[model samples]
Target: MTRLYSQPPRIDAGLFFLRFTGCLLLLHVHGLPKIFHFSEELTHIEDPFGLGPWVSLLSAIVAEVICPLFILVGAFTRLACLPIIAVLLVAMLFVHPDWSIAEGQFGWLLLIIFTTLAIAGPGRWRVGASQSREVRYGAG
Candidate 1:
């Protein structure tokens, strides 16, 4: 039996999977629809910080779409995940708590995943994973 942590490749693969899947969920399941329907959705989304729906929707699009795409390619994985994690926190803790705990739970799960990917990185299988790891961890 081989423990997953005994190898770097396993860790890298896990990171890659997490990075790809989590971001894909944020992009396709969440962001893409809103983006495609931007005109209608612009003022309909939540204004968590009272920033107005337009600003809020734009923020969500960036966090869930632009950043996730960066994460998907490992181009700037950690930097990308930061906005998403922040948005999730705002959504789960501040915004949705007034509505329902169930909604918050989803945010929490994604928060955990993004945090993990932010910490673990996109793995060596990714485009710039090695360089990112070195810059982030001070490793060679």
Candidate 2:
């Protein structure tokens, strides 16, 4: 039977690349703006669930800014992805359901990237990875 996976080093490298690039794009495009322009974002953020604008904007900041930082460093990556995924899902599905695929391509693409990371994890290149390995596989 054919091998189902690449070598460890290659897989780790790919995971790191995906995490780094995806998180970086999210941080740069969405996270920083929400941070630097807090008041402006407050004015425009969608309150899809009628939770109020402050709650909505704060939720977005947590997901886009704080969560990406965790994912970027490969710590609690799967857990971190949950908020990002939730926020993107809300934005795409609830807040902007009228957007055509072309109009919403970026959000959809980010969803794909983060969803992939959530499934694949940060691989062996992650922070505390050695500790996890030692625990899971026994000391080598």
Model 1: runs farther than 4 Å from truth?
Answer: 1-7, 99-103, 128-140
Candidate 1 per-residue C-alpha lDDT over 1-140 given as tens digits, one digit per residue, 9 for 90 to 100: 32232335677778888988898888887889988999888757878677788889988899989998888888888888899989888887776767565746667778999999888777778764343333233333
Candidate 1 Cα lDDT to native: 0.80
lDDT of each: 0.80, 0.89
- Model 2, 89-132: lDDT tens per residue? 99999999999999999999999999999998888888777733
Worst 10 residues of 2 by lDDT: 131-140
TM-score of each: 0.81, 0.87
Per-residue lDDT, model 1, residue 52, is 86
In candidate 2, position 33 carries an lDDT of 98
Report the number of the highest-TM-score candidate. 2
